[model samples]
Target: MAFDERALVRGPQPAVPEIVPYDDGWPDRFEQHRRRIAVALGSRAHEVEHIGSTSVPGLGAKDVVDVLVVLDDPDDEAAYLTDLERAGYELRVREPGHRALRETSGRRVNVHCYAAGDDEITKYRLLREHLRAHEDARRTYEDAKRALAGREWPDMNHYAEAKGPTIHRLLREAGWTGAL
Candidate 1:
């Protein structure tokens, strides 16, 4: 489903993302969150994997660790949302087919939840893997990100939106042709 503003739990907030150099600690952070999510959801957490720029080694990102958790049914929030909350995540986005929660304290980690078979899951993996294997693509993406980060934005989403073209282009280079 399309993203709805109403799905935003904390409402809109202005942002000029601070994209930083790749950190050697990013993978550890992802693993920490992954473990916490696994324990919280138990068998419900079908799979938990790291995604996004931080997941690709030597790639600069927003200093936030991005993780993806595949659930049997993410729409049924009652099943996993509270557990995540109790474990220190707050609902950030709740669009259909997907949900996003961020670390309540530092907001350093973002957990993107999706139901099994969601196309986004595949897109994320493809891009992450592609970026990991291709140094040139990773450099191109990191450069695009640093350039975009220098501008102002009404919302963090805008910064992300600005990166769409570059992202889709790289995805296509990775052979992804699915709708954005």
Candidate 2:
């Protein structure tokens, strides 16, 4: 099934993403959430990793921490969903192989759930690693992101969608041959 946005989401339109300069505190923020998530879900969290622009040092981003929570079976809600909710993440997207949640306190945090061995998960890692290791890729991505930030978007998803092409290009440049 397609993903559904059910909670902690804003109105349907004009969601402007403000890309901010890289903050030294971003990692700490992610670690704080990661620890809480660990206490909430325990080993089922498999891996609680920092993803997205905020994960990369020196890259400007929307200031939301993107977290990747790898689960053995993301579609099995009974396994980890309620626990995550209890920990403060509100479900935001539910789809075939993944789920998305956000911090309930309006803090800038997004949690993505994906099953083990999911190709998309690998993409996230690859993109993050590429940006970290390559200065040129990071600058190009940051430039694209800044260019797209603050424009009117029907949903914050649109802002993310606008950055897709650049991401794919960078991914290719990184020698990833997987389907886009």
Candidate 3:
């Protein structure tokens, strides 16, 4: 199936990504949603982790809780997408090997579904763990995010792309060997 990248952009394009101070409640919120997702996905959810900036304590981020759900077969959307839909998560982006969903329960969320053993999964886990253990790196990342958040962006995707370089550098500094 051909993936339409443009379809990922929902609603009017944002002038810039909304970045906010980290909330102390973010972790609790993630835990709450994690349980719900586990219930929704059952055994298909091999692993569900709290990722992104919200997972890092004291790090400022957009007020969205990002969760990474590792499935046995991510491409088999029919097996789990409907389950998420029933749980109030609306599918937003359908890329080649990834899928994104937004929660409709007033709380903001971005659930990233990926196949087990996917390299991107390793990257996300490494970054999150690295940031949690290294204070200096976390501060540096927070500063960069604050700076980038001020710039005007064509859309959310553009804003995300802008952070790629900084993320790559941080990953290297974190001793990531670029291997899955």
Candidate 4:
């Protein structure tokens, strides 16, 4: 399905949520969520990776941990959600063609589960790895996030799109030619 890319760049929208930049406790939080999700997904879950800003140390973020889970069969997410609910994660957003994503009770996480061979997960990993490997790019990304956090955009997607140009520039510099 095509994402509403315009949801970010066009007209007036709802006020963006407040972004709280925090310390490196984010990864620990991700680990906590990861273990629970892993147990919930069982064998169907191939791998769970920490993505998004919180995964990067010293980066100012919206205090959310974005995780990507690669599953053996993406269609079998239902089998996992039952256990996920038990583990305190709630079904938040549904992007049918991409992945079945969930959020934690505290609303501090975004857990995305996709099929094993999906390039979405790979792309996320690649961008993350690229940022991690390049100090300049990482710093640039952090600064951009900090600056954008101050602007009151319509929503998280808007905020993300606002950072798109900078991110894309860095991506190009890092030789990241994958889909964004």
Top model by lDDT, which number? 1
Worst ten-residue run, lDDT, model 1?
1-10
Task: Give a tens-digit lDDT track for model 1, residues 57-168.
Answer: 8998998899999998888999899999999999898788888999999999889999888989999999999999999999999999999896678667677778888999
Work out candidate 3's RMSD over C-alphas.
3.0
TM-score of each: 0.95, 0.92, 0.89, 0.80
lDDT of 1 at 171: 91
Give per-residue CA lDDT, model 2, range 14-103, as digits (tens).
Answer: 577888999999999999999999999898989999999999999999879999999989889999999999998887767688888889
Superior by lDDT: candidate 2 or candidate 4 = 2
The reply for model 4, stretches above 4 Å from the true place, is 1-22, 75-77, 100-104
Candidate 3 residue runs with Cα over 4 Å from true position: 1-4, 7-12, 105-107
Higher-TM-score candidate of 2 and 4 = 2
Best by TM-score: 1
In order of TM-score, best first, we have 1, 2, 3, 4
Clashes of each: 0, 0, 0, 0
User: What order do you get sorting by lDDT, best first?
Assistant: 1, 2, 3, 4
Candidates in order have lDDT scores of 0.89, 0.88, 0.83, 0.69
Candidate 4: tens digits of C-alpha lDDT, residues 21-127: 55668889899888878887776767888997777665667777898877666556565667766877665545553443446456778777787777767667766
Reference-based lDDT, residue 47, model 3? 91
